[model samples]
Target: MLSICARHCVLWSIGRCANGCRTRTSHSSPRFPKSRSPTALPPMLKPSVRSAHSREYLGTWGISNGAQPGLFTGTCEGPRCDASGPEKGYTPHARVQQGFLRLLVRAQSALVQRSHHKRRNCAISGARFKRAREVVMASYIKRTIRLNPSQARTLSGFANRRGLSEYALLLKVIDAGFLALLHGTDRETDLAEMASVIGSISERLAERGTSREEASAAEKQIAALDTREAKSHADHKSLRADWRATAEAKGFGEAAQARAIAEAKERARAGELAASPEILAARAVAWAAAKLSERQAVFPASTLAREAGDYAFGRLSHNAISAAIAEAGERGALVPRAYLDRRGAESAGFTTPEAIATEQAMLRLEAAGRGVSVPLASSLAAARTVERAARQSARAGFAWTDDQKRATSALLTSRDRVAAVQGYAGTAKTTTVLATYAREAAKSGLTVTALAPTASAATVLGEALGLRGDTVARHLVSPEAKGLGKGAVWIVDEASMLSARDMAALMASADKAGARLVLVGDVRQLGSVGAGAAFAQLQQAGMATAKLANVVRQTNADTREAVMASIEGHAGKALAALERGGGDVIEGASRDARLATMAQRYVALSPTERVRTLVIEPSRDGRDTLTAMIRQQLVQRGELSSAAVRFEALEAKGLTRAETRQAASYAIGDVVRFARDYADKGVTRGSAYRVERIDPDKAAVALKAADGSSVDWRLRQWGAGKVEVFEC
Candidate 1:
């Protein structure tokens, strides 16, 4: 029976046995016919039960069941079969059959040895293999990791050296790395324990003989580590929560959330969202509308867009802002104005509805002022006397230019209550023309009153015109303002700096008091800080204007030319003229270096030259930086005193009428500096005083000056454009 089973096994292995046995062929081999079954196969030749390992090992060789069909029944009729096994003429070769049996025995023995070796290895390695198998079986997760070319090459090289397929090598590497990480954590714990033991020993030693500082330092180190560990744990928990929230928002499952979080972090690091055009546009438009609503009611579209870009912190391009503006306008969030057509709105400007109403009110005030006549001179005799005085003044070497003379004559003789003099800068409009007007108006029995937008300007105008200077804001709230009538002439310097609201108020007061209002300033200079180009608008409306075209303040011809060019908005030509006139444009590698260079140059100048020098910077930040550098240089050279009194100086801000009228805005003990003279109350311009008390019910404040003198000042006296506060 053993011989018979062995022969059948050999025959089955060769695929030559024929007892309804199907021939097993390789995938690429040809199919063969099956022989008819004569009877059932011998019982010894039937399929047998085998171990799982043996089945798995033999499965690769296409031998799952033991002793394939037709192995024993052998009514052998295969093309290669002799058909003479025992009862047939032919029989299998003894040598070939014996060799095949030996080969099979060796293969089985090798597989058994491999299995035994794996078991022994697992036992020696603390069941590492078993754990790995369990891990593989428990987790069926599939992941694809992309590698760069360099990493791919490195992986390939390592896999080849280790005689492993790439997939097997990756799995092995992952397992090793995981084990190493766990081992590292265990080592850290052990080291921490060792450190604790060492710290205890050090403390004990210090109590006996060692220095206390060493022990304390070790204790501090341990405490610091504990703190760090606690902080790290907190951070990890927070990060996990945040990641979960993000994953939930993105509808990501647990397995995919980690990859999504990593990708999001990568995008944030790259600034993919913050720098996007859509984000920039949205931020800019929102910030711009907010700024416009808070401060100015109208702005040049381009200027507002630029400011909005800065507000967005992105400094977006003009095109981006333009697109945003177009969208905003369509939605009625912004009103485009000053444009002849829709197309011109891009370049003309933008305004709020409130600003448009304010403008209309201003125009109405102007029209009313034009109708009310306040004749400065009662007769031709009075006018002749004024002209003679002007002529005498010009002959005395303080000669008025033709433009100045014309402006003065116009102011003196104009019958309208409101008159405008469009003077350019450095034209001596205040010193020569307005001074002449004040003298002539006074001689003609008209009381001349000088007002300016700021304290320093009001003071200068008052000095030039030989009158008490006051701010427009202060004059509006003064007691003497009610007494203004037919015989009064009011001269407002820096008229261009008055917002539409302020201008309208001034006009209304003059019209009501039957006083002549004379506006003197260059419309080309800085516009109003708060809102509305009132002066420019009035001039555009063809108000009676006497223009001072020539500039006399600048004696140098090149400087005068540059001034004229600048006034005409030819900035390039003005700069060229300045350069030709020995003006130095200092530049350096960076802003700091340039400021340092300017400061050094400033320090090298004589006291008088430094006083005369005007450092004009476009931005407040640049001015501050340059000023700080100059101050440092001055201190180093001992040109300025090192001793300094520190105080909080609040720069004046332009406020609206509503803000000025709010009594709740005022506080007790606040220090304020008046920008206009209040002679009757002994309050001088540019004098700082502390608020002794506030009477919100009475709308008044008690102010105490440095000299201990106090006055009950009206709350309206603290109007915008009239006072500044300082904290000391």
Candidate 2:
């Protein structure tokens, strides 16, 4: 038989030997709702005694060690507990003095012993007292057939060196176990888990303490989560109710649902709806927050939105607010736009506004630093759909179309001469074209023809169609567009920079296929890489004479001022005019700065002059800088014997694609951050190439990793950023 633990702290159980734990049938009544028949019950326990917590000698006495409410009862035993009351031969009660005197005498005896043998434990103590003290300790420690003398010698050696007795080890275990219980876990398990977490925390301490900028805020947030306050919850709820009541009284009917409608009406009433200076500041803050989040410094929108887009006093338009994103992107402004979305959502996705701005910065960095050609691309969507093609097709739900009722179905369905749509930046033009394409394409069951100015631009078009192109197209005349059958509608995107020749060629191609045409693009985006040969078709057509001047992108004076400078050929005066007044070069768009941004410049320049002077672009790389970096990384990793990888970083404002391709370079295992995406493909952690096989504009780098692997990646389509050849 083995003795196991009982109700007492002392081990006091008798159990069957060899293994552990025992099972016993309980005799308690069944605990379900009662049935009428007692015969339904199976069996009854033989009459026998049972312990409250155990079967025979194995009782659950240790449960009181924890004693959760309703689980078990506490017993007055173990340490700190004394005999309950005097009984038998002892008196039932004692006078207070008697108790005190007894305690006093015990203390007096301990004091005498301490005084007499205090030095006995010390080395070389006086002979008489040393011997006496040893005798006293030994008498209490008396044992028979215990540890042998030789074993005792080893114990004595340990006690002498550490100055700790065997009892001390027992004390340490109890202390650790008690602490584990307090932390809401089983003693043994909690102790192990806490040790593991603490070890990891110690390792990461250096990283967490790397910055102190938001130290207080982080601490406050942690504290807030750790403790709750009921008062604030009540206050915010009360405030919501009041705001609702006030809005209803004012006929606003709770948070204006249609901002566009409301804005139009307000501006109509005043003849102009310019936002106040404070509103202007708030809008800037919102814009910045969005930009930051795109770059992955994601923040909360409640921190910024109410302050953005000053409509009444500052002349901020909804479109203008959106355009600022492009301006920020171009300027390398890092704002977390994710934090400034409608309804103040803090979702994971970076809307077009935030993403465009961050990518602008990243694109600039890749061009200037690594000599990589990065395009500032976004899933940019425009609000109003284009009506040219859609309106012609009655089934697509266009509001109106030209009255050609007397003409045949040909006039209502397709046109002989192609139509062109052009605009820059904003004006809700591109969006219009895309919407028209989607609707008309859906209606006709005919493949729509599309064109782009460059391979990258073509890819952009393909993205709009949920497809990735097989080959990069330099002009709309590429073979990819020939698939359109007769009676189809052709959509030429980014049509502004497109030559009238390519448009003419595409029109011929479309005509051959019996397809109607609607050409769309941003004229401000540019038609050529400053190439004389490239613009000949456009120059011959003289379509540059057609212009849409009601500037839809910027309704705010300051935003318009900024965009004026941002568009390729119109920025110099915008910047100079802005600088002449309150525009804070330091804070960018503080109140004074915004005011200054609205000023007029002494002289205005042509589009060419403005782009040349105001735009601070470095010459595009003659060779691929980023490709070189990748090749170098490959060489370092022993993956390549390269044509070479070059590392270049630029701060250019208008870096060119031609120059980027000219300087293009790469290596294996090179990490890149896509200027267009900060995450999703923001961090390109892999690239490696085997040197002998690749073209100048492209690299045949080995695909070194799988998706989300975090290391060694290869890409089919890529852009470059500040190249780090050796380290990336």
Candidate 3:
């Protein structure tokens, strides 16, 4: 810092005092009057400092290192004397801009100093340092040091903007002198987290008592809001984002904009311009580092650090010259390397870029020496259920909603007592209710047969109840229960989705097995498969009626809407309302960058593949053809494999929805191939399913039979099967 400050002030006449630094008054030098008050010039002002009336007025001026520090009236030549603008103040726009930067610099300084004070234990009574225990009980510095996913994101943005390594930013912050802002934030966040969890549970229960579906949804919603605000700040506002984007619109040709800004900053600090090759070498080294990482930007334009030092600087634009060079066993840019060489040759005390670069290198090397690893989540719900041995009950009476507990106590108080659970809304009501009943029933040493109308419905419920996670297998009689001493209870999950044959077979098995039958599902959500619709018909016949009201939806609006809209037939409209913009749209976005990004997401793609995209105005007709063209193109361009395509509908796969939604606007004759995403990663081979139905948000499809069952596909994967109708 001292060196940087010194360099900034060096070219000015009133230089900062240093150890034994000397200066002689040059007769021809121009003089500018100093002022005791900022706006008031010296009483004895002069056009030039004459030998007879010259006296240093060092203390008379307010020396802000920022440009335009008051006029220095000296008869100097070259830059100092070159004709400049009449007034030293900034132009109209600049005044505001400069003022803001000055304020920011001071703010950052204050933050830095505050941290410094905390570390040094500066005066206990000092206001900023007071009540240290409470101020830092949950130290931000310690937590930030842990490198959580969120903080890493923030650090990455900062470093990327400055054209520095993220590793460098981490080191800079951890520098003991910079960690003073660690007060109260962590504890406050923790309190919020707890409150959020409790409130979500309470709200869920109030809305839907004993409704198992609602409880599961409420948990996911509470978590999304918890991170949204934090994520916004971490993402950077779109305003300043344009300046940081790596593309043609940045309005530059040769090097990176960040690199240019860095060079300008270096020049501002080094008043007389770089006087040594070491400075130029630093730029070269910086350049080399960028070229090595496809992720890093190349600084465009000739740099001052290079221009002022060596011939190597100009050579950088040449094809073969690497931006940096290795010198003395350390990675160094030409400027720094030259500076280091000159230092050895001349014994100057100036710091070389290579020295600083080495320190940064060592830090990276040390971090890389350590290794760590983690796992993947592909249907974590099912995995978790399996891990718990299929138990859904909490240690304390299953953490049920009061209404559910009431129902459980009233109708199910006795261990072997039979109760037919029911509900619809906020979730897959029928399925959740039966699953909960099945869970409680499991502990009675009695088997519970939860029948689902369709294989898909069975698969959905299987996620929680610990079954084969398949429908066909779920309804078939298990040999283990052939002659059970204790009778089993029957549960029909998504009973509305069962076919006549499956439903009849299920009923036969339940009756023969002496199982008490509990049929559940939302007839409004969708009618049952084939004759399985018989269960909902039972309600019309009046066995026992239980209607569920009140909604318990997930924190994620999309998931909640998906469950709700399918029942109402508007899932697509709800989903399409979500705003989406940030993505790879601008040209010159390195294809590789886009591809690497996809690897993190739908990992099966490579950078060089020709990506297919379509632009269209909002319209209602001709979407199918467009979707098909896209799919055709994918196959034509070899983006998606052909063997993975299938043509099956929700019926073939056993999924049910409200009459209006059953089609999901299904063309009634649509077909498609399916693909499976592993841990949301690789697109598994032979995983293609057929698109059986279509709607605003997605197409419902039956995945190709692997062992034997239909698959549910995500809307995002929909490619070429779209209608192409457009408006002029």
lDDT winner among the candidates? 1
If both were scored by TM-score, which would come out higher, candidate 2 or candidate 3?
3
* Better by lDDT, candidate 2 or 1: 1
lDDT per residue, candidate 2, 1-728, as tens digits? 21222122121222211112221111111212122211111111111212242212111211111221111111212222234321110110112112222222222233333444444332111111112221211111101111111101101111222353322322233233322221223233422432232223223333456222222222222232233222211233334565456445555553554465556555643532244533454447544453333232344443323224422234556555556544544555533334434345465322334344333442332223221211111122211222334445446543222211111112223222344444556654433345444454555465554456666766666666554422213324455456555545555566554433233454455555555555555544654332112222332443221233334455567767667677645656667656664553433355434323322120134436645654211323312443344345546656567564565443323323321222233443333333333255334433421222233322223222234344222222344332222213
* Candidate 1 per-residue C-alpha lDDT over 228-249 given as tens digits, one digit per residue, 9 for 90 to 100: 2111112333345654564455
Ranked by TM-score, top first = 1, 3, 2
For model 3, where is the 10-residue window of minimal lDDT?
A: 37-46
Give the per-residue lDDT digits (tens) of candidate 3, residues 581-686. Answer: 2133333376445433433333234444334433342432334444455565557667678876565322232222211122332343343332323444223443
Task: Superpose all Cα atoms of candidate 2 onto the true structure and report the RMSD in Å to 1 decimal.
Answer: 32.8
Best by TM-score: 1
Show where candidate 3 strays beyond 4 Å: 1-411, 414-419, 425-436, 469-482, 499-505, 556-728
Off by over 4 Å in 1: 1-335, 338-350, 378-387, 638-643, 652-728
For every candidate structure, what is the RMSD over all alpha carbons to the true structure, in angstroms?
A: 30.2, 32.8, 31.9
